[model samples]
Target chain A: MNIKVLFFGILEEIASTHEIIFSDIHDIKALEKILNNQFPDLTRYKYLISVNHEIVKNNALLKDKDEIALLPPFAGG
Target chain B: MNSKFLVSGAIQLEIVTKSIASHSNKLNIGAHSVFLGQVRNDVINRKKVRAIDYSCYQEMADKQFQKIKDMIFNKYNDLTCMHIKHSVGQVKAGEISLFVFVSSGHRIQAFKACEETVNLIKDEVPIWGKELFDDNTYNWKENK
Candidate 1:
């Protein structure tokens, strides 16, 4: 399974890419570990995971071509 | 629906006026509540903010905006219409960044719906802001 993860706001600056693909990722937890290891600076900020446009708190399983997004705290009014 | 939720440059004053004018035929709407968010030139850590650069995950943001509209309309049955606009790219201080308008048959429902909608938008939207300072320093704005 390949997961397409997007980084937004400051997370994009930390990750240095707008989007990244993780191959054969088992679940969201595993993906987070990989992201933390890849971009240690991203660990400092708080963010949420949105799978296919909805925020998910639990360890949601990833599927092939799942569009995952790393969103920082919202600031819209 | 896409027209109602906008992510564009600074909102024009004419658009606001036109929106209000367009609602004249809706006799059922007795009240309207509006909320406008402007960029402030606040000094933070000795740096004065010059502008705000906004960005968002557009596909997700569009969906979230629609969901919010549906939720608010369902919760406030008397609500007649809801219009939301948010800025993208650079918006200078004193410029309009966000505009939310809600109309209803009564004043109370309009006020409540508008307030709740603004709060929900600030919390749920994936939009992000980069606060640019006069001294070339920058900070990411976090919702409080």
Candidate 2:
């Protein structure tokens, strides 16, 4: 299975890109572990995880073509 | 249902004035509440702020704004109209970056809705600001 992960705001700088593709990720927890291993800097920041545009508070099952986003704190007015 | 909310750069004064002038035709609306968010000049890490470069996750932001509109309209049945515009690019300090206008049949509803709308935007939208300083360093802005 393939998943597309998007990083926004300061995560974009920390990840060094906007989005990335991963393989063999089955669930949100697995994906989180992979991200922590690859981009350790991400562990320091607080953010919300969204799967396919809906914010998820807990681990969610992932399928092929899922678009997961790491959204940091909002600063809008 | 209006999705176009991102405006490039600073929101000009004329835009606000023209929006108000155009609402004259809506005779039923007795109260108009407006909110403008200006970029503030602050000293960060011993450097003076120069400007703010705003960025957003456009697709999600639009959907979130629509959801907020729905909530607002449902909560305030007397609301006649609501308009919002936010900056997407660099805006100098002291320039206008956000414009929110709400119209209603009474002043209290308009005021309450306007304040709530602004708070929702701040808390929900997927927008970020990078504060550029005089010495060329930048820091991400955090909402309080």
Candidate 3:
């Protein structure tokens, strides 16, 4: 399973890339752990997770080639 | 282009004019309330904000807008119309970045719906704002 991870806002700045791909990830929690290890700076800020364009909780399942986004706190007007 | 909520460089006055013009024939609408959010040139540590670069998870944001629209319409009995436009990319300070309009049969409903829509959009939408300072540096704006 390959997961497409997207970084936004301060997370994007810290990661230095808009998106990246990981080879194996069984669920959202696994992906989070890998991401935390890869970008340790991202752990400092609070964020939300989106799986295939919908925000999901920690127990959400992951599928192959799923697009996952890490979103910081919203700042819209 | 298909979505009602826009994410452009900057929302133009003509867009607002056209939106109002399109609703002219809807005679049931008696009152309209609009809220325009402008980028401030606030100085932080001697560095003034020159502009803002807005970004979002577009697909989710569009879905969220649809949900908000449905929720607002169901919650407000008299709301006749609603419009929301937000800026993406770079918008200079003092420019309009967000435009929200709500119309209803009475002034009170329109005002209440407009305020509620603005608050909900700010809290629920997956949009982000990056403040670009005049000194060629930037910071991510946090929602207050």
Candidate 4:
């Protein structure tokens, strides 16, 4: 299945803002593993994942059109 | 049931109104709360903020904004309308970085809703901004 992934903050600096197409991922955890391997710098920062606008745990199941966004904590007031 | 909500990553801030004349209609709304977030020129360690380059996980930020809206709607009883705007890219100090407007049947609820919404955005939104110092250096704020 193809999922849309978004990156922000230092993550964006490491990974450009665009969707990556993954062919065979069992779950969100697998996706995270793949990403962490590609961009090891992201593992150092605290982040959250939203599946279709709802915050989900690492094991959340993804749908075809579901939009996944990787958000680092925000420091704005 | 009537509201104007937008989520974007551009650098412009405007008064968002679905219909301009809707403001004049006092039939439903008794009070309105407006909160504006301006970029500050100072950060920790006495470093002066020259400008802020804002960026976001747009897909997630929009989702988070919508969730906040839904939460406010479910929690408030007298709210008539709400709107949230955030700036992306470079924003100079003293310029508005965010705007949260809420209208309710009374002043208390409007004020409370606006404050809550802004706080939620600051705490939950996936938007990140980099602070540029006057000395031609920049630092990215870690998400908290």
Model number with the top lDDT: 2
Candidate 4 lDDT, tens digit per residue, B5-82?
Answer: 333333244464442246767578888888878887878567888778887656556777899999998899999888
- Residue by residue across B98-120, what tens digits does model 2's lDDT show? 99899999999999999999999
Model 2 / residue A14 / CA error / Å: 0.9
All candidates: TM-score of chain A? 0.96, 0.97, 0.93, 0.84
For model 1, the superposed segments whose C-alpha errors exceed 4 Å read B1-4
TM-score of 3: 0.95
DockQ for each numbered candidate? 0.90, 0.88, 0.86, 0.57
- lDDT per residue for candidate 1 within A2-44, as digits (tens), equals 8899999999999899999889998899999999999999889
Lowest lDDT 10-mer window, candidate 3 chain A? Answer: A53-62
Residue pairs in collision within model 2:
none
Local distance difference test values of all predictions, in order:
0.88, 0.92, 0.88, 0.76
lDDT at B53, model 3: 92
Weakest lDDT window of 10 consecutive positions for candidate 1 chain A:
A68-77
Q: What's the number of clashes in each of the models?
A: 0, 0, 0, 1
TM-score of chain B of each: 0.95, 0.96, 0.95, 0.84
Q: After superposition, how far is residue A22 of candidate 1 from its true place, in Å?
A: 1.5
Worst 10 residues of 2 chain B by lDDT: B1-10
**Candidate 2: Cα lDDT at A42:** 95
lDDT of 1 at A62: 84
| Deviation in Å, model 3, residue A13 alpha carbon | 1.6
B64-143: candidate 1 lDDT, tens digit per residue: 88999999999999999999898888899999998999999999999999999989989888898989998777999877
- Two-way DockQ contest, 1 vs 2, winner: 1
Q: What is model 2's DockQ versus the real complex?
A: 0.88
* Model 3 ranges off by over 4 Å: none
Q: Which parts of model 4 have CA positions greater than 4 angstroms off?
A: A16-19, A62-67, B1-22, B142-144
